[model samples]
Target chain A: MLYLDLTLQGLIQGSMYALIAVGLTLVYGLLRILHVAHAGLFTLGAYIAVTVTNAAGSLLLAALVAVPLVGLAGMAIYRLLYEPILHRPPFVALIASIGLFICMEEGFRLVFGPYGNSFDLSPVEGSVQLGALSLQTVEAATIVAAFGLLGALAVFAGRTRIGVAWRATVTDPEMAQSFGIDTVKVRYLNFFIGSALAAVAGVLVALLNNFVEPTMGSVPSYKMLAIIVLGGLGNVKGTLVASLALGVMESFGTIYAGHIMDRDAIAFLFLVAVLMVRPQGLFGKA
Target chain B: MGAYELSLLTLIGINVLLALSLNLITGFCGQISLGHAAFYGVGAYTAAMLTKAGIGFAPALVAGAAGAALLGLIVGIASLRVRADFLAITTMGVGFLFLGVVRQQEWLGGELGISQISESGLGETGFLLLVLGLAAGVFAISLYIKRSWMGFAFDSIADDEDTARTVGIDVARYKLVAFALGTAIAGVAGGLYAHYARIIVPDAFGFTVSISILAMVVVGGIGSTVGVLIAAVLLTLMPELFRFINDYKLLLYGGLLLLTMRFSPAGLAGLARLGWTAGRKAERRPA
Candidate 1:
């Protein structure tokens, strides 16, 4: 029963990881640049959601407002900060992203204060029990929402013209451009969708943890770096699989080796192990 | 100089060492490490613990550097297969792991950290001179390396590893050497920082510090020792100079980084070079 409970909890957390990791992977696929500032976008989404939820008294309204705002912020960041350096070495964009990350994190600190904000939404008052296992309402919501978002994304990417354009751009931007597709617009759309996914994960995380802090996104962002690498860089399906695996490993690691190995250390050690053992990742194609 | 000014100068010296160290790896070797602070922390803790155990300062510093170099070798080897963004993330993870270990281990002083690190007995003036002398020594070494065959190998690897390898340059060995040398310097800086501050906390060497050091290198002009030195001094003092806008200092720093990368990818040194060349061209035209 305890094991089953842990599995359920792991899946819930893993779902959030999948959402965040997929966003990172998508951006990496579209642009060779790793958006370190994506974490800032995640934090912004959470803070904005918190502010909106507190003011308007509706979680749905908060998501509707904050997600788009964060998405626009992502697009704006690309245009203002990234577009000029797109042709430069990847490191230049990376350093710029790091700088943007610092600005956004510090900005959040100055605006929201350096403390955690309680997620003002009331808790869903019940839990569902199945056989010997029980799941909290928020956990269920997180799992459902994560899968729903990912499924919607998979379908959109598979069925739609924009999705085909996106995949084409990912495959080869110059080739896609030669095909009359606006690679630049595709990149912007990619950023928007990725940022939106991160925003949803951010809000879901706040709901699960019941608090949002300025630095809340930092650790997860680093962990998601590990996840993306574990899933073989820009592989979407691999990212989802790696996220769940990491979630489960973390759950069990916290249970058994929590005293010896710090929970954070476990994730990193797993990352190192993966890098050492299978540099291409488990599900990644060579 | 006043105590405040002397301490600030000492800090700049330490930061210069750190920036130069990172410049060696990232700027010169073309390997990005987001965990440079982990080496710094390792050096600090090693020196602090050894000195706390009554070891001599010289030996403690060496141990700190050696310890960091060892960790650097391990990380370098582990991340050998990865490149660019993958390498950056790997090093970043290593940094987090270092902090996590420090926070969890009571022997390393855990969250409370180690304090009352016995002074170097060199006081502020003497310590400043010591740090300055060491910084100059490291600067000379960097210049030598920059002009040597090793520099050529690093440059080739940075430009294109496969090509370098095809040309018979042992990319792996040189990369490990760069990692070891850079991390060793970072460890020395950390040791100096620990002794000077008389207290060491794991939090002091987190990702922010790593980013700050990287910022110093990039803003200074990657691979230029003198540029790194000047940039280090400028960034370290900028916060103090602009105390009125203290809250927005990081934001300003970030903005400066973005602007610098966009306009002058080579940093201040690059800008200076460009101006020099343009002035020469104008003078020749007039002639």
Candidate 2:
């Protein structure tokens, strides 16, 4: 029963990881850029959602406000920062993304204070009793929302015209543009959807923890890098699978090795091991 | 000079070394390290532990460099098998792992850090001179490498690994050497920092420090030794002169980085050369 509970909890945690890592992977797939500032969107989503919830006393309203706000901000970042520097070396874009992330983090510290904020009313306090097991409302909601949204993403990318166009752009932007694909709009849409997904993940994790802090994105920033690499960089399904697998492994590993090494250490060891054994990534082409 | 001035000058020297070390990795080898502070931290901690346990300063510093180099070589061998960018992400992971281990362990002094560290027998002036000498030595070595056959191999690898490999360069071996040499220098700087500050904390060697060092290299112009030195000195002095800049240093540097990457990917050195060429063109065209 305890193992089942842990597994269930790990799945919930995995869903959240999927939510964040998917956004990161999407950006990397489109542009070779690491999109390090994607972590900023995660932090922003949490802060805005919690702040809105605290003020309006409505979780629905918080989600409504947070998701689109950060989504547009992500689009703006693409247009303002990344668009002009696209011609430079790949490292230029990378360093710029990192710089932007630093700015966002420090800005959050200055504006939001160094300390963290807590939800005045959280729906995640109690646990639901399932047959011989228990699950928190936050956990069930997280799994449902994350997987359901991911499913929608899969369908959108696989079935819809815009989805096909986005994938086409990812593969060969010049050819897609020559075919009159309106690649710029596709890029904006890609960023909007990706950033919205990150916002959703941020809010869900904030609900689960009942706290939103400035530096909350730091660990996830690098941890998701490990996920993207493990799933094989620029692969969405791989990221999702990798995130869930790592989540389960971490949950179980924590019980046994919590005193020895932390979760980040475990994840990085996985990254190093993967790099050693399969540098092309676990799912990447040989 | 007053004691404060002397200490600041000494720090400038140490930071110059750190920046140069990163310049070798990111600027020359084109293997970006977002976690360089990991090597520096390892060096610092090893030197701190050894000197605290009655080892001499010189020996402890050497031990620190050796420790960083060994770990760096290992990291290189593991990550350099794939794309160059893999090294970047791997190094970052290493940095976080280093911090996580330090923060959790009771033996490593955890968060509060180790204080009242034993100082080198060198007087303040003597220590400053030693640091300056080391910086000059590294600087000289950097110039020599710029003119060597191995340097040509590194430049080729930096430009395009596939092309370099096709041209018969041992890309992997050269990368390992760069990692080993760059990290060894970082270790020496870390040891010097530990003894100079007379205390060491885990946070002192976190991501921010790595970013600052990268900023020095990039803003100084990547792969430009003299430009990096000038940028390092200017950046190190900026915060000290304007007291408020200390609090906002990361924000300002972050902004500077964005601007630098956008306006001049070649950094200060490139901009200077551009201006020089422009001036020469204008002079030649005059009536």
Candidate 3:
């Protein structure tokens, strides 16, 4: 029963990881570049959501506003900084992303100060009775929200022309462009979608943690990277499975863990160990 | 040497070693390591704790380099196959895990870090000059590496890992060596820093320092040794130029990065090329 409870909690938390991982995986798959600033963008979303929710007293509305705003911010960043360096060496993009990450974080620090903000997003207060073990209402809601968003994403990708175009762009951008697909448009859409997903994850994390700090997204973002790699880089189902397993392992590891062996270090050790043993991750096709 | 001046030069020398070490890894090798600072922290914390436990500074420096090298070796083995963009993220994990260890482990001094690190042999000024001279030697070594066959191998690996492997190069071996050596240099920097600063703080060697070092490489130029040296000197001195912005120092630093990325991808090195090339072109095809 304890194991089950831990598993449930981990899976719920893992859902947030899955969302962020998917966005990251999509960006990497499409651009063949890692967006280091994605974490900063994630933190930015949480800050914006927290302020909006506190002022307007509407978490739902705040999500609506903050998500798109982050997406637009993502687009603007690409337009302003990345597009010019698109054809340069891979490190150019990496450096630019690092610059963007610093800009976002330092900009936030300048505005919000370096201290962690105790954000009061009204969390779901009730608990769901699940046979022998009871789960918090927020946890149940988290699972539903995660699966629902993922399901919606899958449906959108499968049933829509835009999604098909995105898939084509990922496979071969040059070929897709030659065939009359607007590669720029697809890239823009991917940026927006990826950024918005990161934003949603950020807001959810703030609610779960009950605190929002300038560096809040750093650790979680790293964990999500592990998840994406553990799952196949571009495989959605693989990412979902990997995230759930990682979440449970991490949670149990934390609760029963020794002082010297932190949950994070152990998790990363597992990641590094696994990667060493299996260079391509468990679910990775590559 | 004046106390303040000596301290500033010592810090500058240490930072030069760090930024140059990272240039070897990121600039020369074409890998972006977000956790480069972790190696520095590992070195500092290791040296401080070891010396506090009665080991001399020289031995402590070796231990620091060895410890950081071991950590880098492990991280390199795990993620060298990934390379570049993915490597950045994984190295970040490795870096954070290093910090997590420092924060959680009791032996590492946890949050307080290791204080009262012994300053044996040379006093403050002697130590400063010794370290700075040692750093100059390392800089000379970097220049040698930059012009050698091994340097070409590193550059080849950086340019295209798979291609380098196909051309009979042991990509992993080169990368591991570069990673280990880069980290060892960081360790040396940490050792010097611990002695001079007289206190080892975990926060000082966090991601921010990693970014600053990378900025030194980027806002300077990727492969230009002199550019890196100039950039490091200028950035270290830039804060001294403005007193009012000290409170928002990091914020201004961030803005500097944004401006550098947008306007000058090649950094100060790029500016010189811009003028030189434009002048040459004018000479050839003037109306």
Candidate 4:
């Protein structure tokens, strides 16, 4: 029963990881750069969602506005900073992203204060009992929402023209350009979609935890990077699998290792080991 | 030196060293380290503890460098297999874990940090002069390395590691050397910092410091030693010069980083490069 409970908890957590990782992997798959501040956007999404929900009195409606707002912010960032410098060296882009991260962190700190903010979003009100088991309402909803989002993403990426353009850009940006694909447009669209997904994940997370903080999003960013490496860069299914596997290992590892192995360290060690033994990752194409 | 001038000078000297050290890894070797403050912290803590245990400042400084270099060597070994961005993420993880260790350990003084560190025999003004001297020494050494075979190896590795590897250069070995050398410098800087500040805390060496170092390199120009020095000097002086904006130091720091990179992608080094090229051309045509 304990094992069952842990597995359930791990799966729920893994779902959230998948949502965040998928957004990050989407951008990396296309740009081949680590947008370090994308995590800041994720942080923004949570704050905006919480603030909106408090003002508007509806979690769903708050998320609806927050996602697009975050998406537009991503678009504005790319247009104002990334596009002109896209021709520059990759490091410059990275530095810019890091700068963006700092700006967001400071801005949020100024507005929200260093201490965290909590929101009342858990519809569960408590926990549900089953045959020799129990599960929180919020946790169950997170898993369901994660699967729904992933399914929708799979369909969108597979069947849509915009998705096809993004896929082509990821495969080869220059060649896609030669083939009449507007790489910049694709980037804008992808950033929008990716930022929206991250925002939605932030919203889902707020529901699960019932609180938000300025610094809460940073650890998850590192964890998502680890998942991307372990799953194989550019492989979406790989990210999902890796996140779930890591979630299980971490859940069990915490139980046995007695906090000696933190979730971040465990994920990081997995990434290091993978990069060492198989730089291509488990499912990443060589 | 007056108080304000002395303080600015000290800060510039320290930051210049820190930025230059980071340049060896990020600028020359093309490895991005988002968590360099860990190395800085390691050096500071090791030096402080040793000095507190009755060791003299000079030996403690050496010990700090050696300890930081050893840690860097270990990290290099653990990290060399990964590619660029992945390596950045991994280092960040190590950094967070290091902060956690520093935070939790009681004997290391926990969060309150070690205080009452005895100053070097030099008085405050004399210490500032000494720090400036050390800064000049470091600049000379960094420039020499930038012009030598080792610098060539690092540049080639940065340009294309695979090509360098094919040309019989040991990419991993050179990277380890850069890591060790850069971290050793950071360690020495940390020692100087502890003695000057008269207090050492883990919180002092966090992501913000790392970001500042990265900013210095980015604003300075990665592969250009002079650019990094100028950047370090300007950035350090800015906060002290405009005390009103101290709370927004990070905001302005981020803004400056973005503006510099966008406007001068090659950084201050770009101007240096142009001057050198023009001088060479003039010499060839007239003489």
Q: How well is each residue in A157-213 modelled by candidate 4, as lDDT tens digits? A: 789997788788888999999999998888888889878888888887877788888
Docking class of 3: acceptable
Per-residue lDDT tens digits for candidate 3, residues A156-275, read 888899988888998898999998999999988988988898898888877777678887876766677777777867677888888888888888988887476677776676776667
Candidate 1 residue-wise lDDT at B258 = 76
Per-prediction DockQ comes to 0.63, 0.60, 0.46, 0.45
Global CA lDDT computed for model 2: 0.88
Instruction: Write the residue-wise lDDT of candidate 1 on A71-120 in tens digits.
Output: 99989988988898888988899888888888888889888999879766
- Cα displacement (Å) at residue B21, model 3: 1.3
Best-matching candidate per DockQ: 1
Q: Please give the range of 10 consecutive residues that has the lowest summed lDDT in model 3 chain A.
A: A117-126
Screening candidate 1 with a backbone cut-off below 3 angstroms (N, C-alpha, C), the clashing residue pairs are none
Query: What's the TM-score, to 2 decimals, of chain B in model 4?
Result: 0.92
Task: Tell me the TM-score of model 2.
Answer: 0.96
Give the backbone clash total of model 2.
0
C-alpha lDDT of candidate 3 relative to the true structure = 0.80
What is the per-residue lDDT of model 4 for residues B1-287, given as tens digits with 9 covering 90 to 100?
57878777887888888998999888878887877888888989999999899999899999999988988887787567676776787677667666766765677887788999887778879889878888898889888988999989999988988999999999989999999999999998888898888898887887778889988888888878889999898888787788977888998888777777777877778867878999999989954
Assess the local accuracy of residue B114 in candidate 2 as a C-alpha lDDT between 0 and 100.
82
Candidate 4 Cα deviation (angstroms), residue B45: 1.6
